[model samples]
Target: MFTSRAKIAQRLLRRLHGTNATPLAKRPARPSVTMGRALALGLGGAAGLLGSAMAVASLESDDAVFTNWSATHSCHPAKVYHPESLKELIDIVATHHAQQKKLRVMGSGVSPNGLGFSDDSILTMSAFDRILHVDAAKSQVTVESGVVVGDLLSHLRTHGLTLQNVASIREQSIAGVTQAGCHGTGAAIPPMEEQIVSMEILTPSQGLLTLDDPSDHRFQLAKCGLGGLGVVTKLTLQCVPMHKLLETTTLYTLSELKKVHASLLVENQHLRYMWLPYTDKIVVVTCKPYTDGSPIGSRISDDIEFRLEELRALYKQVATVPDPDHVNWRFTQLRDSLYALDPLNARYIARVNETEVSFWEKSQGSRVALSDDVIGFDCGGQQLVSEVAFPSANGSDLTFMEDLLARIERDQIPAHTPIEQRWTASSRAAMSPASSPLQEQVFSWVGIIYYLHEASPSLDAIKDAFVDYSKLFEDVMAPYGAAEHWAKLEFAPRSALERHVLKDRLRSRFPLEAYRTLRNEWDPHHILSNDFVDELCSTDL
Candidate 1:
């Protein structure tokens, strides 16, 4: 039924967009048979046998080295299983545990890390995607773990309901995003995992476990389990009535932002700022609920597209230039050209201004659209990213961020991508960077991205430069009690984690002991363990 409905939706979307391009929904093929027997059969008699058969039928011998969306990490798994039902998932886990084989769960593989990789077997939740129930009165929906955020938002739009917040990219699976501690910009909104009211998990030791009560200690542990606890089968999420949002973007100097940062946070429902590398210019985006019947604005305007194309062309030209001196000259010219385009660039003389101003002008605008449409920004091509979260010294000070920026400039790091800053409320999830036992009202998340343009001949050089720059980044952030985002480019080993300056701070902030206890009890045999999980959990701190 979902397949046919999805096909019809694809056709309609194609007609609406006036394009013959194949829809994203049509990219992945589904299997013929679903998992398990009806609930009437229960868990015994023919039901158990049927479930096992289904699991076996769904299993495929996959020996390919799976690469993540960013093409950053790859791992070869022995086999892959696509279980469509709770019973089948339980059976698969049991079989894998009995065979003493390790297992990992993957959903769309949007994370840049190697979290979903396993040498033994991988269980993909894509087949289990479905919306089981919706309670309009409570403004809640129950969906399988594999449901993508974009699809979920679209489904909820028809019912006049939507998630309270979503990350910049909507392609990640709900379970994937939740477990990885994905968050968006807003002082009131916590990570996506906070929206999950309850979830059903299939564990090797425990056949099927339902965590419904938010008061339960285990619920907090399981919310951001890093895929170390078990496989999440389904989740019940709290939602709000659908609404439109007004988005405004403008260019601000770093000095100017420092003064109004507090007011900006208070005035907007969602706020985020981007700092261009090698420059002091920042692009500030503020979004708030819009109630007036203003016409919806286009997500991307022609002017914005034109600027982006020009930037791309400039980068392409730099890649082809053979002379190092000429390349450096082009870089300066490109920077100057970008600064010239900014309306605010005229305030500072070209020679006196050392702040980067490119791309800020293109993104500046005011648009009123559905909250989801306005919030979801493009992920921008294959890239590597590192996002770190640190506690706000005060609710409104930008001293720490200012110091960090100065250090980057002093060190002369070759960072070209924008540094994004956003705020989030404290979370209850044990492993979340934003988690706080004190229930802190605000925390700052800073993200640094590096685009790995595949077509560029200087890709190798860029990667090398990023590696050296990242070491300095880690060193500078270490003293601020910063924690790396679970799904980003954090390759620190167990030894390094123990030695980290903020190790004790993180241990205290996150309920590390309690989480370890619960994880051990649920996954005694470590069937879902991977190198990353093991290293992370092995930290003595």
Candidate 2:
């Protein structure tokens, strides 16, 4: 589903002006506070009077920063709760369920959308960080949902085990990453959720339940439940033996990418590429299982260091412009100048090569290290990002990618950031972007990013530019059945879902009917629902 660029621009302006522009009819009304507060007071007072062992801090302040890492979306919950134990978490959920108060579960608040935003209450799972068990023999780890990816990796490494894959950013909690279907680049590897052997979910009705059977249909629904069905407390993930990896970075032209695209996916254990907009050059990175005999050396480069300084200076000059309109114009000029640089320039190409080369070199190159250090890379500072996944069932043609690049060039979309292209095997999770129950082997993910550096003119200007380019991207890729990444930024509205083609695509691509049924059966009162989830799960489409 898509919206017109003009409407998207108008919406961005309204948001920038600090106004609630969402239509009243479309916005879900916040739950009644009188009933919620009364129930909360009753349950809480009873527990305090009884001197119950369960302990949790309840906050009423509405100024909490429940925003994502990018700081693009923020929400103010009527109450925020941090439960340190399973009993405490259950008590909180039961109280809210009785009070008819909606709840949204959050973990490090990594989602770029409003998926975790709620007016009734917000439950932070960070307190649940505990490694329950480590089965070194089976190569599996059982941990609480709050365990951060980095921490889990370190613990697992001590026991000679590691996760199968991780997102680009390893700060996200394990539950958060799995729920959002976070994935790495590899044709043979699936998203993080696929590694789950079992999980303990606390549903509003079922209370605390464990799904240990892989054959159970509910496992597929709950694995990527979008925090709808329940709160994930603990998960048992099937990990692999810890091993080191060797990574290499190389630059290639557009023509070269087309020729080697097929081989690249199969040749390396992990492969990803970044295409520079308005240029024919791209950077390809390959990570494979490291063994003896590989070369070990590191070369320092200052190309990126120099470019960062120049960018900082340019941003400073643009920010000094007095008029807002002039600031916008200057920002446009900055983007154009950044994108128009010739790839032939020794310094420019050197900078691109160094950036990629140094990333691996600093992390794992020149020496074998854990996969977490090798596969994961910094996503950069705060930025606005929109990533979409399209099925490359055939894995041969690059028409969709070629058309996207062509459209950006023809329209001169002011896209200065590199377009990242990655591949992943099909996922069994119904809501996964790369979901293909029919046994499709490969899928492609294309990410569009607009970095909101400190020197940027304004958040509004960056958002406007991003929306403009995204609308064009959506229009061109819609024919190929593209699906937005759940954790990334997307502007699709409910009205757009009414399109027959998009509606059919979504229905077929995702098990929406089954998910709807499971959600209704488990969360009949909609306590775990939010505006984003509601719109996305709407049956009207």
Candidate 3:
């Protein structure tokens, strides 16, 4: 049986995908499917040997490589500075400024869009992780840039305070989260970036810029500056009292959700939908603060054994192909199981989608928990995931989503399980995806995901399919004034014309002119940018 080997494989998968913002060497091209980079994933060796190689790969070196969480982007910087203090951070920037060298500030490496990639100087403030102060009177917590969300929440719980909203992942740094304009689900609540009361930035020409002055033009721009304006050293966030929350997961079809989405938005403090493709169901997850602390609803989460049995039955019939150790066979065993045989076939994919719908039907209810715990949930491991934000002012986003799913089925795109949908109120941050002149407007953030387990039998081909699927969404969302989420925005290999097209796309959606003006004025040397950033805001464009 592949059970024992699969368990060991998962253990090695987690270790091999290390993060100090660590970098792993990309596996060389395979002549065929044999091993399928299993050695690089630590699957070839026994567990002992696997542990040794992981240590070696994880150890920081003189020429240490920096790879993002997705392993799609990496950089070997000339210097990786972990500045311990604000003074130290300023000094590094000042030196780089004097040398006319570029610097890209990296937080916890949570961004998958190459937002922090630089071949020059890479700055990580991992050493500057400290919760400076918790103001009891104001309900605010001051933290250094490197302080991650998980740590901050634990500290906040002790102080009887929590963030106004939560992000999907706790491992993300406060700086990274805000810069990306990360958010939770709520039409009434703005993104995490909107929570920042003030921030201290280290710019090249300006030196140390403390953007507390709301009237200042740079203040709003700096809040969600896409990590390009400068190195975010410190932030003060407005917090709320820590409390228990009641969460409920209710299932609905797309038509049902459309009929009741307005009511759902009105009733719930936190709301998000998990729309399973090739099926008629959408998993509705709603959370609200429960003052009484009484738990409601039985937990209707996944019955793993039941799910496994269904998949096993299907696999026994359809999975004639061998090679049980394929890495993609775990969380998405059904998808990979089918893909291992016939990839992207509409008829075959429908069978897998039916299995997913069955799993959701068997388990979809909720329980009570802390506000933080309920807000942030699991976003599956390693994949090509991208979220596009578009105006939902008049249910336009709803129309867009319906059209997207229709397109997927019509085009017979071998789509994944959940096309997770979330909503956020407007943000003042100039570059925030949800930023708008009208404060009352709401935007929908829809994530299109395709898991890319490296040791999968058909990783390359499936990745190509994902690219096509994602591009289709981008094309469809364009008319809806859609903008890619800053953190998950993607830029693949492109021509000069395509690059210009991308810049034009952003120009239509974001306040690019103001952001670029501030960027140029503050960092005249362009020390705080990478190629991906430069591509978008370049004056030459």
Models sorted by TM-score, best on top: 3, 1, 2
Cα lDDT of candidate 2 equals: 0.66
TM-score of each: 0.81, 0.79, 0.85
Residues 1-541 of candidate 1 have per-residue lDDT tens digits of 1222243233223322222332222224342322221111110010111111343533333323455666766665566676655676778888888886888887656677756666667777765667888899999999888776777888899899999999876756788889989999887788899999999988788768899887788888899998989899989999999998989888888778878888898889899887765566888989989989765454435464454544545444534443344233333344433322321222322222333355456656788889999887755656667788887656432665676677766776545446788888889887888888767657889887666655444556656666666667677777677788888745552256434644565565577777777778888878887877775566754
Give one digit per residue, the lDDT tens place, for model 2 in 1-541.
Answer: 1112132223223322222222212212111011122111110011111111227555564333345566777776677776756888898888878887888887656676655666668787765666889887889889888777777887788788888888887667788888887788888888888899999999988888899776677988899888988999999999998887877666677787878878888888888887766566676777788766767555224344332444434434434343343233332244433323331233443343333333323332233566889898756656678888877766432677678878876776655446788888888887888877756568888887766655544556667767777778778768777787888735353246334445566677688888888888888777887766765677673
Task: Give the runs in model 1 whose Cα sits over 4 Å from its true position.
Answer: 1-54, 57-63, 294-358, 393-397, 458-461, 492-508, 539-541
Candidate 2, run of 10 with poorest lDDT: 41-50
Please report, in order, the local distance difference test score of every candidate based on alpha carbons. Answer: 0.67, 0.66, 0.72
Alpha-carbon error at 289 in model 3, in Å? Answer: 1.8
Query: Which prediction has more favorable TM-score, 1 or 2?
Result: 1
Model 3, span 1-541: residue lDDT tens: 0012222233334555332322233222101111112222211111111111221111122434556666666776665565544666677788888998987887666676767667777776654566888899999988877666777888889889999897877766788889878888898899999899889888888878788876676899899888888888889999999988888877798778889888888788889988888888888888887877465768765556664666656766775664565333454545555545655566776777777676667667777788988898766656678788877866786788789989998888877767889998988787888888888988898998776655457777877888788778878887888888887876675567776787788887788899888888888877888887777777556
* Ranking of candidates on lDDT, top first: 3, 1, 2
Cα error, candidate 3, residue 318 (Å): 3.7
Global fold similarity of model 3 (TM-score): 0.85
User: What would the C-alpha RMSD of candidate 1 be, to one decimal place?
Assistant: 8.6
Model 1 lDDT at residue 284: 90
Select the stronger candidate by TM-score from 1 and 3: 3
